[model samples]
Target: MDTLVLRLQPGDDLRAALDAVLKTDGIGGAAFVVSGIGSLRGAGIRFAGAETATRIEGDLEILTLAGTLSPDGSHLHLSVSDAAGRVSGGHAAPGCVVRTTAEILVAVLPEWRFSREPDPQTGYAELVPRRRSSQTL
Candidate 1:
């Protein structure tokens, strides 16, 4: 396993930046978001049972972030607190704009490949992890 540490600048979209890491050379196509923290000017979070994300605007502090990342897609969850101390958490979506900085740590798994496939039971695309030989990498 290898690791990547990144500090995202203001105005950067949190989700898009993470997705770009998978396309970088030597990433080996799969990674897990070990941890992340930062401040966001605005965020888009999809709550449980919600079809679309709710736009949250204001000075928000990221409390936690974690998930899997693959070329096929990513599944991340995060919690954030507003200036008023209201906390919200759910599926992390695109359009989460950084305010100050976003510090992230990712674990790259070179021997494994991950993809998303539809699961009949869940009726949603889910992660499918597979092991590949060194030759493939």
Candidate 2:
């Protein structure tokens, strides 16, 4: 398995950059181990319980980003700061825009491929182990 360390520069969209990497490497699935510790203009993050998105404005600092990446869909969560220096976190939605830059490190397991499937019980798409499921430890 190979690990990919990606550093996104200023003026780049965090999500978009990751997508580009996936396309370039022909990677349809993977996982992101995010550790953001920098200043940004601002960003939008949606919590799980919130029905509607709340606007968080001002200097933003990445607190944490934990989630998965797959062909089916991306289940990402983001945490950013507000003008009052309050921290906010939630599921990364469409409105999320990178302030200045975001650095992300992804563990690209070459031997294993990841994908997303809809679970009737959950009513949402989530990352799932692909072909390697048959292989036993």
Candidate 3:
């Protein structure tokens, strides 16, 4: 396993940057953990069994960001706190703009490859892991 640390500059979209890294670096499998003070000009979050994400507006502090990242895609969740201490958390979608910066930590698994496949039980695509090479652990 290896770790990659990133600091996103102001005005950068958090998810966009992450996706770029996944594509550019060819990260087959990884876990993303992010936390920092920033603003989400507009954030998209999904609650409960909803099929789509709800848009949230305003400057917020990123309390938590955690999820799995793969070359196929990512499933990230984000929690942010507002000025009044109100906290909101859900699926981290695109369009989450950065205020000052976003610090992210990625744990890369070089020996594994991750992909999303359709799951009949849940009706949603889920992560599927496979060995990258035919080597014993």
Candidate 4:
């Protein structure tokens, strides 16, 4: 396993930057361990059964960011705190802009690949591992 650390600058889109790195590096499978002190004017979070994210406006501190990401797609969760110390968390979506910086470490699995496929039972696109095919000499 190899690791790649990314420092996202101010005014950068958090989600987009992460995605760009994974795509650019051809990282098919990875686990993102992310952290940093930053601010966001607004954040979009997806709650249960919601088709899209719910936008919240304010300058907030990123408290918790955890999730799995792949070239095909990503499943991330985020929590932010406002000036009043009120906190909100949910599925992290696009439009999460960075105020200061965002540091992310991606642990890459070079031997494997991942893709998202729709599950009939769950009705959601789920992560599916695609291992490298091998052949005996």
Best by TM-score: 1
lDDT of each: 0.95, 0.64, 0.77, 0.76
lDDT of 2: 0.64
Report the lDDT tens digits of candidate 3 across residue range 39-86. 666677886678888888888888888887777778888888877888
Q: Top lDDT: which candidate number? A: 1
TM-score (C-alpha, index-matched) for candidate 3? 0.88
| lDDT score, candidate 4, position 100 | 76
Off by over 4 Å in 1: none
lDDT of 4 by residue, 19-135 (tens): 676676455565555554467778888976788899988788888877767777788888899889999888889999987777776677767676788999999998887676554
Residue 55, model 4: Cα distance from true site in angstroms = 0.7
TM-score of 1: 0.97
Query: In model 4, how large is the Cα lDDT of residue 122?
Result: 96
**Model 1: how far residue 51 lies from native, Å:** 1.0
TM-score, predicted candidate 2 vs. hidden true structure: 0.79
lDDT of 2 at 121: 88
- Candidates by TM-score, descending order: 1, 3, 4, 2
Instruction: Output the worst ten-in-a-row residue range by lDDT, candidate 3.
Output: 28-37
